[model samples]
Target: MASYWRTPKPGRKIPFIKKSPVENPIMEPSIPTHFRCPISLDLMKDPVTVSTGITYDRHSIETWFEVGNQTCPVTNNVLKSEELIPNHSLRRMIQDWCVANRSLGIERIPTPRIPVTPIQVSELLSEIASASRRGDRARCRELVAKIKALGRESERNWRCIVSGGAGRVLSASFSELAAGSFDNSTSGVLEEILSALAACFPLDEEAHWHIGSPESLNSLVLILNCGDLAGRLNAVLMLKELVSSLDADRINVVADTDGLIEALVKLIEKPISPQTTKASLVTTFYLASSSEMTAVKFVEMGLVSLLLEILVDSDKSMCEKALAVLDGVLESKKGRETASDHSLAVPVLVKKMFRVSDMATGFAVSALWKLCKNYEQERGEGCLVEALQVGAFQKLLLLLQVGCTGTTKEKASELLKLLNGMRGRGECIETVDFKALKRPF
Candidate 1:
């Protein structure tokens, strides 16, 4: 250590010590440089050495890799591997330092469990795969249980299992099990696989395809129908991710699955939780948007009525999602007929306008436009009249004045024209000066 002093000053030049540079003369404990994570600057609880020989907290380094950085944070060298080796010796020293500084309010870092390794994850996956081949359901379930536990340990372990191809392995097992018609004995194992599989999301492209395959779709259907709440929740969320990536042919295959639409509607009709309801709504929206046949099926299932019911009572997030699903449903003529027929649909949707968020208002206005456009050809037909009677006309006027996207503004303007049509011949739109008010848009 070098001896140094504060620059000679008017009064005193205090000598510097090896410690306490970062602390004040008022006597706070100084933290050592190596004890902190470079990224977070907090004490490193579970330090590991990266491929570049730089040590970091395990979580800190995993986050670094997760964000698409392959280079060392310190030296800027490209990392050859993502392996994280536990620095047990340094961790012990950190614990000891904390214990010695306990009087200064430092807490000891707990000893960390060994993180799952790629080879270990691969071996378990292999064992599970082999057991499935041998038709040893017990062994396969036990192995999946192990993977599920490891996945629960840390995001680092989940990354290990994901990169090692657990998604394909688990989906294949679930597909085969599901093919047996979903007996009582298989429920536990199926749930285990889904729990583990969902944790690996943001999966590799190959894994995504595996999960979205026709066989896996059957498994998802069975889970949605008879499996428990957690299982159904996982199924719908998985379907939401899967549907977006599927081509038109594959989505048509999805829409064609017998009893699939029924199960989804049941989930929405009898929502297990807000999360489950939201996931099913989003999944249904994607399917309905992708296929006209699917949209017709949902309309037949009274999805519009259910969504309007939700809009009348649900929370903000629920209302927004329900409105979005409603808008998608109205894309079909049958959906518009059902919505316009329902006693509360027009009023519920009109109630949402200018009240929730801009998105909700947009969806509400879009939906009204669809119904209005449907009945616009029939002058005395009541869709536009019904909307205006619920104060939708005033809300649309306010929405346009508040400012919106070009598309929404256009929709609002068109909706205004439609609602104004129900006015009497003497009570025309010209009575209210259209361009007199300043429109921010």
Candidate 2:
């Protein structure tokens, strides 16, 4: 769970300052002149211990064998214990050398590359919108051809449409591009088509928002119904983003809600291929996670079992995404009560806590804790005590101790405090105390 995406740390490299005279005793010159290694009268480098775990470098002990200064000068006896002599001197010299030699001047980590320029993208998007308005399929295809020539993989995710989900794709040679052609009539139609494809296939915002009419949604649905699995998955992804700006109430009112939901549910139930199945599930998750509360509606319409099936799947990615969505749903106003009514939901999620591969168990635990909190608030303190009796508090405590890190520390601490208070040992709101939690587990 460590993020590799670190922001650049900006600062000048400040060199280590030498300690003041007060920091150390006055140096003795005769000791080093009398006892210096014959090879070189300088401090040791790469000091290490021998078989007896007694430390000595080539200049210290080996020099004793060579130049016959075996008996210690300062101790005035045989060098019995290297430990008796200070080790910090050697360590300090090595560190000082490294700082002087190996340091870089004002380290500059390379900035991450942005995929496309905003002005270029915005212009391309507006062209697509114009082509769609002008009904120039051939011109749109020509525009896409030039854009595609720009690069494929780099622009794969970057190509954005304004409202491709709402039907903008059709106006910009969407159907033609989906067929692997970009034959449109207008001079800049290729750019328009590319923008439309960006919006619809990649569902770029510029492309999606520029969607010409409702026909685009229908066109995408048709493409999903007819094309191969990738096409279908892409179509659903487009629909997910398009629906974000779209009023669900309007879509439900204007289009066939039962039809669209049924198609999505059917795809969720039986996808054409496993890859398609997973891709569709992700689209479903995006839809569920989308702000429209479509997932909640799907649950209210009795799609919980369908979603749970995905959540329990062996696929790790799907499980994580699905669990995140389920977590979100269970935290939502309506989803909270609905999840509580379902007896098996909590138990299944609790079991996931045991799996090492499920890195999302922390999120699951938090969601469940919140659900229980909501349940407690609605029911009574007695309900919380009942949940604690059922081992909720112990599980949460274990989760906090093991799983909590970075930002989650405060949350886990707060939850533990509350749960401890509810165990009836002390107070939480009025005062914070957890002396009872210190006992050996």
> Candidate 2's residue-wise lDDT over 134-172, tens digit each?
665665555555445543534322332222232343433
**Stretch of 10 with least lDDT, candidate 1:** 12-21
Off by over 4 Å in 2: 1-171, 175-204, 211-213, 225-228, 240-262, 274-295, 354-359, 377-392, 406-441
List model 1 lDDT by residue over 287-349, tens digit each. 888867789999998888788888888788998888888899888878888887888887887
Error of 2 at 131 (Å): 9.3
Question: CA lDDT of each candidate?
Answer: 0.79, 0.50
